[model samples]
Every structure is written in structure tokens, then in C-alpha cells.
Target: MEGFRLWPGALDAEAQSQLVQAVFGALGTAPLYRPQTPGGRPFSVQMSNLGPLGWVSDRGGYRYQPTHPVTGQAWPAIPQMLLDLWAATVGGKRAPDACLVNLYRDGAKMGLHQDRDEADLTAPVLSISLGDAAQFRIADGEGRTRTLRLTSGDVCALTGSARLARHGIDRVLEGSSRLIPGGGRLNLTLRIAR
Candidate 1:
């Protein structure tokens, strides 16, 4: 965790509840959809977004778009709590233009991958974990990996040398928390996607 920073319990119970509500509100407009890998394999996690740009993937490839792929409407604005979290944790004048909201239920695991689609690689990717705990794995280009338990309300940032590091969620510990109504994990990653 040399280049990564983790803040345990970054949001209290009430704050987490409010943030969950904001996510649901955004979902109403841009519903979550399962994305397929470039090779046509479906991803386990369903995804949506808030902010001007949203991260999406399909058989075409992974990229960012101004509008939701399903609805073809512009994505809702990033929640105020998320914007404030970015401003406080990342501490820069420029705010993140993309917020990728990933919903992972039981058995949903993201393969290790690097986040290099953004124009500015220097900007940190701030990830907010809600609901259940996930076994988050991070590694360098050499493939040395470390796994950490990311619980509800925890926040982590990948910045500087770790910005493009290989990372993914191995698995979510089911029934870890009741923060999510239907039982799942929600990961919100704020990024500068310009």
C-alpha cells in the first residue's frame, strides 16, 4: 500500500445511508447494466454512473461517454457528498468529471486491470466502498499483489505511482453489512476522465 491511501470509516452510518440514497436516485435515470468485455464475456458486476461522463464497457471496448449507453441521456450530476469527498481527500482545484458506480452482488468479482483510460493519469482515483466488504487486490506491474478487506464506509485512493496499478475486487463477503437493501456492494470511483 505504498502509493495507495486507505481511510477506514470515512463515512459514518448516517452519511453512508445518505450516499446510498443518492446512488439510488441516480440509478432511476441511468439504470445499471451488465457490461461485456471486449471479447464478449459479460462482467459480473452491473454498472452505472453519475457526473458528466460515465465509464462503460461492451464488446466494442471500454471507454467513457457523456450519455448513458442504455438511455442515451446525459448522466446525472455527481452527488454533492462525493464531490465534497473528492475535494477533501484528493485536494485539488479540478473536480472529477466521471464517477463510475459499480454494483457487485454475491460471486461478482472484477478481474485485475489497470485504469488508464483517463486523459490525466496524474489524477488519483478515489474509490468509496459501501455495503458489504470486498477483498480488494492491488499489485504492481511485476504482479506482486496484496489483498485488503474493504468494508462499508471505507475509502481508498490510488494516486501518483499507483494511479495505473493493477487492481480488482476478488470477491465480496456476502451478508457482511446491511447497508444495501437487497444485499450487495457498491463501489463509487471518482476519476478525472477528460
Candidate 2:
């Protein structure tokens, strides 16, 4: 009741599958790429974003914008399915200006970090877990930590005390779910980017 939420069959199965198709489809048109860190090393995972503003990371730094860097064109539009999920998941929250999409292949993991780049912490972060399930770990700024299994249709919203809290995907089990064709997980975090 406190840390996470379970939206049992929240996507009605069909919708979930459709969204996955849209995500992978867009990626095929514009594949996800590992951006270089400020220090000039490639980040471990590949990422991309959608909507009015797309989050980007590179040797320069992390920031948000309206176009894809590689394509020099507009980022793929945020699918309506994503918009609907955000509405239902956040309980009427407006459609996010930016949707950060992270693709995790089997065994891929993300380091713990606070999503502090967004302009306002008041607008909570809405995350939807699709494809395979993942072990999501949330660490309080105060040092306490808790991990939960965020599966398909699971909606995780970070707000209030936990807003801007440090968190990350510990690791994704290769074949945790059959929801998606590939043995991977797709996580989408919608936010109001400045």
C-alpha cells in the first residue's frame, strides 16, 4: 500500500501486447543506442524517449528535448496506449511531456539513481512495466531500501515522500514473462519535463 501498486491485468492483455509492438516498432525505425557518459564511456544500457520532450544523455550531459539526436528529427510520438496508461496509472494525471523508454535485455540492470533531472518534483513519475518482470529497488534519500517485483501491467508511481527518491532496476530475469516475444523488459517512465 505504501511503496508500489499492482494493477492486476491493468492493460487488459491485448493493449499490453499492442503497446509492446508499438515500442519495438519505433525502435526498429530508430534503434535505441547507448549514450556516452560525460566521461566519454558508453552507458551500460540503451535508452530512448518519446513525446513533446525526449530525454537524452551523451558526453555532454543528460537533458530533455523534442527531437531524436541521431535522426535529427522528431522523436517517435508517444503511443495513445501509453497516454491512456499514464492517465489510468496516475489517476488522472495529465499526459506527460516526456516519456523515458528503457529497454533491458536479459540480465541487464540499471544503477540506483534519483530521477532528478525533471523540472518539478511535485509532478510524480509514472512507470509502467511491460514485457518481462523486474526487481525494482527503491532507496530512500535517508538510506533505507526496499525492492519489489514490478511485473507486466504493474504501475509504480513515485510521489510525496518517495518522489525523486533513488531507485533502479536491479536486474531483469531473462524469461520472466511471456507477455512479450523477446526475452527482455520494456519500462516506460512518463514525466513532465521542463
Candidate 3:
């Protein structure tokens, strides 16, 4: 876990609530929609984005673009709170230009994969967890995998050698938190897309 950093409860409950409101505001412009894999299979999680670029996937393959795939309009600006979080946690010369908003509901889960679709792979991937806790997994340098429960208000980053590390969510612990309406998990992943 040399390149992985976990800050449990980095955001207090009040801050998390504020962030959730901001997320919903962005979603008003760019609503969450399920994305398909390059193979045409639908993902379990619904996704949207904020910032200048939005990460997308389809039969065309994974890539980042300036506008929402469905809305055909530019993505909303990254939330100020998230910008502050990134600055404090993964400070660097450039601010993240893409923030992927993933909503995991029911039994939704993500398969292990590396976040290498960005042009700036050197920039660390900063993730904020809200609502239900997720069983997060990441591959270590020793070729082994480590798992942890990422709960609401927790913030984590994948940087350095682990910038392209294979990581994913195994399953979400439902009823763990009530931050999200109707009960689910929201994962906000900030990264440099271009």
C-alpha cells in the first residue's frame, strides 16, 4: 500500500452533507446514467461527471470528453469543497479536470481495474466515499490484494507507483449509513483527464 493513502473520516458529517447537496446540484445538470462496457454490457453503477472533462465508456471504448454523453453540454464545474479536498489531499501543480460521480445501488459492485484512461496517469486518483460503506480492494506491490471498508466521509488516494494500480469495490454494505437518499453509495473520483 505504499502508494495508497487512506484518511478515514477526512470530512465530518456536516461537510459530507454539504458535499452531497453540491453533488445533487451538479446532477441536476448532468444526471446519472448507466454506462456500457466496451463489450456492450451495462455497468451496475450509474455515472455522471463534473469539471471540464467527463470519463465515458461504450462500444467506442473508454475515454474522456468535455461534455456529458447524454446532455451534449459541458460538464458543470467541480464543486468548491471537492477542489479544496483535492488541494489538501493530493496537492500538485494542476487541479483535477474530471470528477466521475458513480452511484452504486442494490448489489452494485465494480470489477478490479486500473485507472489508466487518463493522459496524466502520474496524477493521483482522489476518491471520496459517501453513504453506504464499500468493501474496497487494491493490489499491493507484493502482488497481493488488500481490502478495507471505505465508509462515508472517508477519503483516499492512489498515487505514485500505484497510480495505475488495479483496484475496485467488491460490495457495498447496505444500511451502513443514511447519507444518500433512498440508501446507496456515492463514490466521487477526482482525476486529471487531460
Q: What's the number of clashes in each of the models? A: 0, 0, 0
| Tens-digit lDDT string for candidate 3 (81-126) | 9999999998999999999999999899999999999997888999
Off by over 4 Å in 3: none
Give per-residue lDDT, candidate 1, residue 2.
65
What do the candidate models score in CA lDDT, each in turn?
0.93, 0.79, 0.94
Off by over 4 Å in 1: none
TM-score against truth, every candidate: 0.98, 0.90, 0.98
What tens-digit string does per-residue lDDT give for candidate 1 at 1-194? 56699999999999999999999988999999998899999899999999999999988888999999898999999988999999889878799999999999968989999999999899899999999999999997688999999999999999988988999999999999999979999999999999
Superior candidate under TM-score, 2 versus 3:
3
Write the residue-wise lDDT of candidate 2 on 85-165 in tens digits.
Answer: 777667544668888888888477888888888888677788888878888888876778888888887777887767767
What is the alpha-carbon lDDT of model 2 when measured against the actual structure? 0.79
Better of 1 and 2 by lDDT: 1
The clash number for model 3 is: 0
When superposed on Cα atoms, how far off is each prediction in RMSD? 0.8, 2.0, 0.8
Clashing pairs in 1: none
Query: Residue 14 CA error for candidate 2 (Å)?
Result: 1.3
